[model samples]
Target: MNPVRKRRLVITLLILGAVAVATALSIFALQRNMTYLYSPSEVDAGKAPAAHPFRLGGIVKEGSVHRVPDTLTTEFVITDRFQSIPVTYTGILPDLFRVGQSTITTGSMVNGRFVATKVLAKHDATYMPPQVAQAIAKAKEAHRIPKAAQGGGAP
Candidate 1:
């Protein structure tokens, strides 16, 4: 091959190889860390992966909020219309996590209870995060999620 043509072919092959490696690395990194958000109903339906780290969100069931006797730990129930999961957290809970309020707990469920490593509560009396509200709205549209009783009546 002509000298210049040989050099051009080498450079082209090197650039193609670099692109291939980058694509592979991107896929590998993506597969290493993946977590899904679930609602109480989704967890109950076995949609969540067992032993996989995941997050759950729902309203704190009425009368289900309680602090441990002498610890930063607290226990509560997250419920949607279809299901409820008991959550335990060993940290200061957000002030807005009162009965009938919304909160999200991050952890895994073990032996029928949600063992939360961290819990975040909504700050306002009537606030739902936009992403969560959208999920709820979509669920509502599907008519696939049950409507829970709220304020003594069906929501």
Candidate 2:
């Protein structure tokens, strides 16, 4: 082969290889950092990862909040009206956090309860996280469909 052609081919191969490697690394890093969102019902149905951190979203159940005296620790139950999951947090909660409000907690499941490291509350009465809203919509749609027609209802 001519030396000029051979050199050009080698350079092209090197550039392509570098790009492939960079793309692969970026994809792996993103996969590692991504966390999923799940509702209380999904968590209850074993859809959430137990060890990896994930975002849990639902409305705070009324009369389910308990705070420790003179401490930041608090316990509450979040619900989607169909299922509820208890959550524990020891950090400062957002000022908007309260019963009957929508919230998203980032944490891992331990001993049947979610241990949250960060808590996020909706900023306005009408605001809700998009993932949470989507999950709620899916739940509502599932319930609206007849069980027989779904093939998993009454048999």
Candidate 3:
């Protein structure tokens, strides 16, 4: 090959390699920062990542909210009607956070309990996060179906 052509080929290959490396690094960073949402039942069934932070979505179980006197730490149970997970938060909770309200908490499971880093509550009585709604709907549907129909019985 001519000297000029060889140099051009090398430069093009270097540019392509750099682009590929940049793309791979971008993907890795995004994946590390991404957190997935899971329902109470999914967490109960061990579907949520045990070591990574994730969002837990469901209704706050009625009468489950508890706060330590003179402290910001609060504990509550989040339920999808079929299953429940206990969550603890140490920061100032949202004004809308209350029993029977839909909420999503970002945290990681520690010793079978969710230790939340942040908590988000629905802005209105009629509004729920789409992911939370879908998760609850799926749990409800699964509860309505019988074990036999769900292929859980003996053949």
Candidate 4:
């Protein structure tokens, strides 16, 4: 092979190899960080895998928060009508982290406690997690569907 041609071919192969490695690394990072969104029922039932991280989501159980002294560490319970999962986060709570607010705490279950590294509270009292709102709507509709099937319409 000619010297110039050989050099050019070598550089081209190196560039293509770099691009392939970078693409693989990007995909690996994305897959690693992606986690499942867990409902309260799933957490309570131990349906979540211990190895994978989770997003513990539900309504903040009313009157269930207690802040420890002089620390940002606080404890609260997340509920989904049928069950509740306790969560602990050692950081400043959002202003909306008050009674009856909806939230999604990102972390994993450790020794029975949901160790939340981040706590995202509701935008407002009237605001709720979209999943919570959807669940509520579905519950209301379930009853309506049965009633309508039996009779003329739902009251």
RMSD of each: 9.5, 9.3, 9.6, 8.8
Sorted by lDDT (best first), the order is 3, 2, 4, 1
For residues 1-155, write the lDDT of model 1, one tens digit per residue. 99999999999999999999999998778863554468988888888879687899888988888888989888888998689999888987776668877788899988899999988776654577788888876756556444552333213
What range of 10 consecutive residues in model 2 has the weakest lDDT sum? Answer: 146-155
Q: Which digits, one per residue and each the tens of the lDDT, describe model 2 over residues 8-80?
A: 9999999999999999999888983564478998888987877688999999999999998899899999899
**Candidate 2 positional error at 23, Å:** 16
Q: Tell me the tens digit of each residue's lDDT in model 3 across 113-136.
A: 999999999765466788888887
How close to the true structure is residue 33 of candidate 2, measured as C-alpha lDDT? 51
Query: Model 1: clashing residue pairs?
Result: none
The TM-score measured for candidate 3 stands at 0.57
**How much lDDT does each candidate structure score?**
0.82, 0.87, 0.87, 0.82
Q: What does the lDDT read for residue 92 in candidate 3?
A: 88
lDDT of 4 at 6: 100
Better of 1 and 2 by lDDT: 2
lDDT of 3 at 64: 94
